[model samples]
Target: MDYATYIAGLPRVLAGAGVIFRDAEDRILLVEPNYRRDGKWILPGGTVESDEGETPRQAARREAAEEIGLDVALGPLLAVDWVPGTGRPPLVSYLYDGGVLDEAQLAAIRLQEAELTAWRLVAQDEAGSYLAADMQRRIRAALGALAAGRGAAELEDGYGPADLRAR
Candidate 1:
């Protein structure tokens, strides 16, 4: 079978999420999957379904609700990525800027057992160690874009519109 055929048999359309929450000192939110396949820690994200007729922002908000049981205020598009040779099909991820109501809400988080086991609020410097190299770059770039009053937009080499999960 060709690559397209192989990917078609895999799971749902791959998507992305912007892990956002507040710490005691007003930091960002992040999550760690319960299991590690590639021995890497990834940000919170999942599939983007075409049937949902949703934009990337809608997909991010949906993932936040389903994965963490929380409603998120979706912000600008943060970053885009493509994961290659990762067992599953090549994935196109659309990251967004997500925020919660307040820091107090971080305490009441309820994780979706089937997806994530727990969540954490980490400081900016601490993020690089816990997250994968690619994620670390994206997060840092997104933060930088937000700080500079610009939206983050980076397309990994070899990734194109055809890679989008919505397709």
Candidate 2:
């Protein structure tokens, strides 16, 4: 097969990266996107530009800076979610730890005017009201991982139990 044909036949998937930013009170930061007609509140993130040679972690940090105007050293990986697609390729989402921001860092948040209309720090219990069901699940799992000091988690469609071991 020709190089073009081989490349064309290769599988393709879209990738996205987001940061889970929290405040001193442990509320998650949620952004209301202006570009979405459905008005889904989401974490600060966007699609990874493959052409830019950016890794998922880099993309997450860049998105945080671009969307929230906060330059922070991102913590470890929190969760990776593989979302099934409708008509297109599936989406692989990476969620990173933005770490708990102090009062000073929280005071400096500035939403990107072009993409976000508002931002709020919502408690964990109230995240479901602001986020989609799948996203809420992902965030909850990530929070659990954070509290336990465990490594990154793998999720399918935002659900856990990545592996089952015999008793």
Under the 3 Å rule for N, CA and C atoms, how many clashes does model 1 have?
Answer: 1
Q: List the residue pairs that clash in candidate 1.
A: 21-29
TM-score of 2: 0.93
Which parts of model 2 have CA positions greater than 4 angstroms off? 162-167
| True-structure lDDT of candidate 2 | 0.90
lDDT of each: 0.66, 0.90
The digit string of per-residue lDDT tens for model 2 on 57-133 reads 89999999999999888999999999999998999999999999998988999989999999999999988888888
lDDT value, residue 83 of candidate 1: 61
lDDT of 1 by residue, 1-167 (tens): 99989987887545555554445465667776877765555556666765677766777778788877777777777667666646665666777777544645665567888767667777888877777776776676666666688756565522334344544
As for model 2, its CA RMSD to the true structure in angstroms is 2.5
TM, every model: 0.74, 0.93
CA-only RMSD, every prediction: 6.8, 2.5
Candidate 1: which stretches are off by over 4 Å?
1-14, 22-26, 157-167
**Among all candidates shown, the one with the greatest TM-score:** 2
